[model samples]
Target: MAKNLTTLALASLLTLPLIGCMTTNNVQPIATKPFVIDSETYQSAGKSQRIKFIVLHYTVSDNERSIQLLTKGKVSAHYLIMDNDDDKIYNLVPEGERAWHAGDGGFAGRTILNDTSIGIEIVNKGIQPQYKDALKDSELDYHPYKHFVEFDEVQIKKVAQLVQDIAMRYDISPKNIIGHSDLAPSRKIDPGAKFPWQRLHEEYGIAAWYDEADKQFFMKETQLATPTIPEVKQAFRDYGYQINSTAEWDKASRDVIYAFQLHFRPLKPTGQMDIETYAILKALNKKYAGRDDFY
Candidate 1:
């Protein structure tokens, strides 16, 4: 009976540690701060849609890398459209959440667009390697070599469908559909010259397009009297570019012009204030200037 007691005591000692370990592992510490839930019977009178703009971009990398970067890295996009033969469109982030695609940019009268924009990242090598090399040499102009790969037709169709659905749901304006470069002229140049803005404008009505007759008339008038730099800068600002209304044709002004030409006169984004570029700017501003919807 005494030997049995000794064995039982040893077993209890061993079991006590196991029991303590189990208790330690299973129990979770309670939070110190108190959280309360509240219910309201009445709703606020004034509210608006969180989403205001749809900003487009090109990943400048392959589809796989683009996905990995956007998902795992600090930068992210709401949607990523692949350039593969399949033309797959992937949703990386939910529409309700803000994506980090438009890092530091603005449009219309609003700054920091990431707060109010949905970003779409399309897979495309923004510039060919040879073209990039030629650009550094100064011996080659962008006209000869293809600046970017053409977007697949199926991909564009899918984008249009997605845009249409989102626009309908959020009541986004056609003018608010813009490229990343348009918002961040100083920093970004994605959804570059090759992006089919005209096609999107004509077919899907995603963006605004100026009338051809008006553009031609303005182009002709520029020959007689070139508008001052300040006038052109104000026109650009009125068209929603975040350009300073400086009288001089400074570097900042040129950069804004580059962003404009990259969207409108893509073949030659010379960054110079020329007749064609000025005409397009004037036409766009004349149509969209001082609209209450933009802000």
Candidate 2:
């Protein structure tokens, strides 16, 4: 009886360890309580809207790659407009939070645009694959107008809607609705020549655009004798481009001119000074900055 009883006790002890293991495995984890802060009674009256500029860009890639790059990669944007049949606009970063889209760029008198600007990345395969690596400084090597891809019609509509919405909410000036290339003329050229700026200006009345009359007046004046290179440089600077006082048509000068043409002309961005280009520059300056001495 004693031996049987002892054997029964050992069996029970062995089963007890198994039961404990099962119980431990089935145990529920305790959830942490959410933290809370209350500040309903205080507000500051001396605050202003953080957003001052809206910089636009093209992803230079397909929709999937663009999405992955903007979200997972080091670069990011406040908004991403997909180039797909679906009309989905992804807001990757919050409007209040700064995104890492504008890298080493400045616009107007402002530097480090990522601080005061909201970036919008539109998905498009920018330059064609064959010409992707071609240099842009010389038209003989690569011309953005010839190589760039057109934005989807749906994408343009979406861009207009989004820009208008943000502009209204933040009271952003039309002049502040600029391209990435406009911000960083030297190293960047995006939202390229193929972007329908004229259409946007005509149809939606969105973004900064010059009056045709103003352009024509400047054009006629420039036909007789265009402004000197130094004067043109000052005009570009006055109109908020980061240009230097280099009297000659140097590479930096050409880069800025290319950026301006990319925004205003789109068709003929030769990066060389011509009557039409000068006229457009003068018109833009006169309209936006109210500076009228083009000659």
Candidate 3:
């Protein structure tokens, strides 16, 4: 009887191990959490318009510094092409969503800039004071105090290539590509005079250009009559400038002139809209006469 009981006990122990194995196999695993997207992520808004323009700006901070500030801080961008030796491109903001670059501005009769455009902030220090941000001229210290940063040759190439990519991807027009300061002149002066707007226009076919073909015709038109305040205001509005027009001519005109200088002739930027500016605007207005088709 004892032997029989021992045999039954051993059999039960063997069956218990199999039961435990079966229980382990039957237990199901929990599902992982779904991914949450950042606000910067480009969620499809059902439709996308052809990219009209590429607005340019300067990051103002160094690559490492920019990364830190943008990552931790609330500030962000659609893309950041560095001015470093390597000149790598960093995309902080997605193309589908708007980036917080253009604060208050108008373009081609459009307002509230963030939604309609893609901003590219190249690493640069714009309009630095003569004594400020100067590097110590020493190789030992990587970052000097107040080192004025400018876009290097490599940086420009990187910008061109990336701009080309964006232009191609979104069908961005060469005429529409512009700078931040172009749309919002009263408040900002960035991607400043030292940065190359002409090269982008002349070489890369970015932004409006004063084509040689229209030079004589434009000159004749400007010389025909002194443009009146209302006419000037109308021209500004027709070209997508944001001005009350009720404001004094000096203030309103300066806004338009500043916008022009930032995009075309950044070197002098006196905001006077001299004969050179008058000619440029006439050319642009002629070129973009039918932008509603795209917008």
Residue pairs in collision within model 2: none
lDDT of each prediction vs. the true structure? 0.82, 0.85, 0.69
Model 1 C-alpha lDDT per residue in residues 1-295, reported as the tens digit of each score: 9999999999988767565557765776566675655558667767778898999999888978988999999999999888776746789899999899998778888898889989999888888866766667685433231666677787788789888888889888777888998999888877888888888889888777787888988998988898888788878877888988667877777778888888888888877788999998888777765542633
lDDT tens digits, residue span 1-295, model 3: 9999999999988777565467765766554775665878567676656456678888767778877766667666788877667746888888887777777776766677777778887777653566343335433211222333456898788878888888878876665677776677776666666667678767886556666556557767778876766776676677767666563557556766766765666555566656667767777778777654453
Q: How do the predictions measure up, each by TM-score?
A: 0.80, 0.80, 0.72
lDDT of 2 at 215: 91
Q: Which of candidates 1 and 3 reaches a greater TM-score?
A: 1
Model 2 ranges with Cα > 4 A deviation = 1-47, 133-144, 290-295
CA RMSD for every model?
A: 9.3, 11.2, 13.0
- Model 3 compared with the native: what TM-score? 0.72
The full ranking of all candidates by lDDT, starting with the best, is 2, 1, 3
What TM-score number comes out for model 1? 0.80
Better of 2 and 3 by lDDT: 2
**Residue 27 CA displacement from its true place in model 2, Å:** 33
